[model samples]
Target: MSKDLLTVSLDVYLGADPVLCEIVPNSSCGDVDSEDLEKQPKRSRKASVKSEDISRSSASSRARHDPVSVLVKGGVAVDPSLEEPLRSNAHVLSELDTVWHVMLNQTNISMNSNKFYLIQLLKSDTEDKYWVFIRWGRVGYRGQTSLTSYENKLEEAKKFFCDKFLAKTCNEWSNRSSFEAHPGKYAIVATKFEVPTKKEEVCKPEPEVLQVSRLDWRVQSLIGLITNLQKMEEDVLQLEYDASKFPLGNLTREQIEEGYRCLKDIENAINTKKFDAVFRDSVNRYYTCIPHDFGFRAPPLIKTQEDFKKELLLLETLKDIEVSYKVLRSARESKDNRAHVDRFYDKMHCQLHPLERDNDEFKVSMVSMYLSLGHGLTHMFSMEIVNVYSVYKEDEYRRFKGSIGNSMLLWHGSRVSNFYNILSHGLRIAPPEVPLTGYMFGKGVYFADVATKSGNYCHPSNGKCALLMLSEVALGESQVLYDANYTADKLEQGKNSTIGMGRKDGVRVPLGPLEDCGGDGGRYSLLYNEYIVYDVTQIRSRYVVEFNFRL
Candidate 1:
């Protein structure tokens, strides 16, 4: 096997960072002078090898001078002759009707590594030339690049590309849809790349007709709170995560799974009440697995259970943020220089219809009921309903309707940054890999009867806005719990969900007309009533309410 192929397999699949080394030609492979190699920097040595390869393989004078057609910063493989700017080749590829790109990642905590490999097949617009571009390195580093040109031989370039992919991943490119990872091979990373739309083809939605004009003047002030793109953008950006720190702008599935394991270990240590050296080590390992940009300051250690709980919540938010950031990054690649939020909004799979304050009776009722539920500490944060959007998610509703029986609308809230994925995929049940300790009612989709109870989950503070979803939860047969049950997924026969009873009840009952919870009204120690459904199919998203919190 060639050294390059071996290196690709190890670096790409084994989660090892690509080592910067000189690529010696086959002729001089066995006769390397250690002293001479020591005299030159590794980069200079690689450049010289690349130059030699180009000069020896090509007859063209232009190819000899501008030897390596390396992938530049923006993932664009520019032929020096074309002299194109360092933007994406997405549009150019679209015009050629040939866009082939794949991302692969492998992160192993045991190996202490996180790595990514990006490969693309580019066809030159000016000629019948083709280039197979490969970039591989550590997750946060620019790493290395190599480009191979097939002059007027597209078939040869394609075969070479597919062969390289097989060699690295042990999976055929054509059969990628059913891709099964070999014991030690790179996992395919799914990414959404948007093709640049022509300005004429872009169909911007027409502005909504004002319903307030037809309403009484007394209710005109409520119209000001309707969500616009600008306000949504402001609220979403408040997450303030440093995407630059994460070159991929998201964590790999493997990395996220590893994070769960790390958190589970920390959770065990916390439960044991052991703040020993081993506990400290576990904390450090968690941070390493899930990197956080704490700026210049060192990350604080999780010395308390409260701190651990906060970390768990942070991990949950980070998982959702990853989805939103990935979409935003792909949006950044488009030629359109529009605001990131506008681009992100255009990429959502589900439709969001803004509800008018004056015309939408449902919105008015929801707002009134939400305010009425504020009792005790829930009333501390003065809530203002900014916008209410009817979520038209057909797929989630289809799956939810499959399960028959008692269904009631309840509240679910999350960070504003998470809305992109939540709207796209609807509410999700926690993955089996996630630690049970991360949730109070085990791994399930949680909802609240009281709007303010779920509102607290938004982590709302003064001058900031948050998002809440009123979802229709199908509780076929309920298991009412007065305390935390980590293994609540083991529902009693015929029970579809778990309802955690609280000491205090909501001012009003559930919004929709649904069957009664056939169980006795036994009280729990929880401050708020929480409903947890183990299956994602039991939840249908209804309205997304955006609200501001004031002290």
Candidate 2:
């Protein structure tokens, strides 16, 4: 099989970085020769050989000179005729040298400005479209070339760009509205080209186009901004990192802060303003800045080998995850007459409270254990098989999983609501949530888990548990109404108003201590507070559970 790729289509996924890009004949960018490419596997094998063999013998290689490497001191670039100063066909390959060359020739600025620098996700509200800044990279950009009119005809162009430049499918996400545009400080300039391959051979290139969408003006604007910002950010970061090598650590803190202020002043002077409100012309001006390396030519846009190494690690991790998913899928499909498919779940390794423990390991244990309880899979054994087959790409499935744990630990879901409100009730045990979705797994409240979401949490240890807990909540607030630290063994199962009766510490607390006083069950929001509101409409027989609060 061929190796998987770390696509530099529009943005980076899983922290993977670009090792090299080539400006080939067609609209496509063949993969780089980085070692990390070997990490992930793909369905196709020798897919690149057909193209590379012809490329090595062709005049194109002679024309571009080096095929595998470049002698760029700053950033990589191509011939004006070969590169198309307006839009460099992305087939050409170059090294970090090209970025350095741009800085050396473009500006006369020092980069050691003192100040606190930070990296933040560009919001749709930001006027900037570029997520990247390149230095010695390609000097020009591909603009709105999707030949679609202002009407819905943009679909053809959109598909073309997806296949050529982005490789993105429109209907893949639940939040289809997310791809829509917003005002931003950055600008993007890109295009998509389709170089159809002859049936017998797939190695040749034939056509090129910009990645812009023809559907709506807003879509066009968004694509443009993404391209522009990517190029610009690549350049800016290249210079910034390079400057660090010649650190003037001897400079006083005040001097550093002063330098930072000066840099901010420069930024303010760079025609920076809100863009989502305005249109067209402003975006064009932004494109002009793509090749401008801060107007300050430098010693060199420096980079360390370590940066690439980290990128390799991320790529490898992605490969591992993909492999695991495949294995799990195969096992799942092999259903037999047996009631359930069983797999080993370790216990002894987790039970030991090791002396020479680590922090990450500790975090994993706490979270894993907590999530395990949600599924009613609590005991620490070497391994055990259980009924957890419904692992697909569904939010309800995850909700079900988390609910399973809550039911195991607390008898039933604390409060019944829609999928979102239910998950929000916090039966999960994950890490922090930077975004509601699409981020590293953080501490979470589960009872809403079935391995959905763009990201997930993995234990840092070889095997460990993560703790999950909920506490009594007051249902008065709008958001989270309750949190209880109920545990196993201490959990008292209840059947209607007769809950927790006769058990040692089990006193039947009214479902709604405020509204119904000594109430029956209907709809109740048990926020993590004393004030409970119970509305009993129709009381039916269902199971209730409570947990041990022992630390």
Predicted model with the maximum lDDT:
1
Q: Give me the candidate number with maximum TM-score.
A: 1
Q: What are the lDDT scores of the predictions, listed in order?
A: 0.55, 0.21
The sequence of per-residue lDDT tens digits that candidate 2 reaches over residues 1-551 is 12332221111211122223432231222212222222222222221122211101011111111122211111122212111221122222112221101111111113211111111111011121211111111121110011111122323323332332111222222232243322221112111112223322222333333232223333222222212222222323332321111111111233223323332332233334322323232222322222222211222221222322222222222222223233333433343322111210010011112112254455344333433332312212221111111112233332232211212112112211111112222222321211112111112222222111101122111222211112222222212222232221122243111121110111112211112223423233321112111211111111111112111
How much lDDT does candidate 1 score?
A: 0.55
* Model 2 stretches astray by more than 4 angstroms: 1-92, 96-143, 146-443, 448-523, 526-551
Q: Number of backbone collisions per candidate, in order? A: 0, 130
Q: Per-residue CA lDDT of candidate 1, range 446-518, in tens?
A: 9877777777777768977677888888888899888888888888998889988776555434443212333
Task: Please give each candidate's TM-score.
Answer: 0.56, 0.18
